[model samples]
Target: QLDAVPSFRMAVHPHIGTRSLDLVSERDKVGFETVLTSAKLMIQEKLSVGSISAHLADKYNLFNNSVKKQREDLLGQISSVESGKAATSQSSKCSHVVGHQAACCIKFGSNIQFRASTPEERESVPPPISKERGLVVREETCDALLALLTGLKGDTCKTLCLETARNEMKNAGDDNSLICDLTLLSFVRHCVEMGAVALH
Candidate 1:
């Protein structure tokens, strides 16, 4: 965005006005003022603040658009990280197990553990889920966000959540077999990245 407009930058931090441009005169004494624009009648005489303001607006608008596009793209990416077409080798269900999905995707708070039909089923994934404290959705959301930061997506952990959810149904002994390992967190991460957020 700053590629044009002479040597101007679209975003001049407030600190720049206070620190770098501090102890300065009203005019372009150190070129800091030129970082954006000088006075109304300083540049080329023909240059108008209206033109500069319009140019800056366009650049900022473009930046915002780019950010928005990226967010949508990320949402789509995370949405399909676990492709519906990419099914497991065995289209199986947790026998005599039950599954329940989270209220929503972000995992903002509340660490919930899905119970099992029998104490044995809980150990299938090792270290059976014992009744414990719940984490707020925000904590889980932060963890999910941090997941994208690392080389590995927090998907495995997300997988565990889904597994636990489905496994809880097994604990109930419903045998519906509607278990899926997709975490809405993955999708939410995509949403945040692409900037198509809920604004909530």
Candidate 2:
């Protein structure tokens, strides 16, 4: 199961936050190149009708499980290997490697965010004015997007996608409203193209 987890090399980007896995490395890069290639291919696979969301959800669960198993296995291996070595010398080496590896795994297993270091830095970042337009605007926008994406005509599907995105934006105090309609449309189109959402 641990081997089943897709392996992709990641590095922190200097600007525009962390890039997607596709932008991280070339196909010929070292370390688990085959795994990375297979992952990219799997992501490119087309989804059948009514299977897009389910397929992604299942993959998410699988990846989540795999990461958990990997962590457990890594720790177990560290423990077993250290048991036979000198306590003082092996302790420092194992701890350093394990700490670095564990940190890398945790970071890669989740979304990456760029945070401001100080109040001045925070102030330099622009606020989202559109979010202040009120929950009604969010609800309406989510309803419209949900209706277009799914055959369902109400708030039922709103919570599934659009609303959740809005809530996260709201919590982060980021105004996505200033984002141009064309860009937002492109995002939705990309989501559909990537099988993250399905249209009926």
Candidate with best TM-score? 1
For model 1 the local lDDT of residue 172 reads 48
The TM-score measured for candidate 2 stands at 0.19
**C-alpha lDDT of candidate 2 relative to the true structure:** 0.38
Off by over 4 Å in 2: 1-6, 9-32, 44-49, 53-133, 136-200
Kindly list the per-residue Cα lDDT of model 1 for residues 18-39, writing each as its tens digit.
7555555555454554553553
Model 2, 1-200: lDDT tens digits are 22455344443233323555656565334444565666667656644555777876787678657656555654454344333234334323332111122122221112211111223332333343455221222342454444343432223233223334434455655545533333233334333322333221
Off by over 4 Å in 1: 1-44, 74-200
Q: Estimate each model's TM-score.
A: 0.20, 0.19
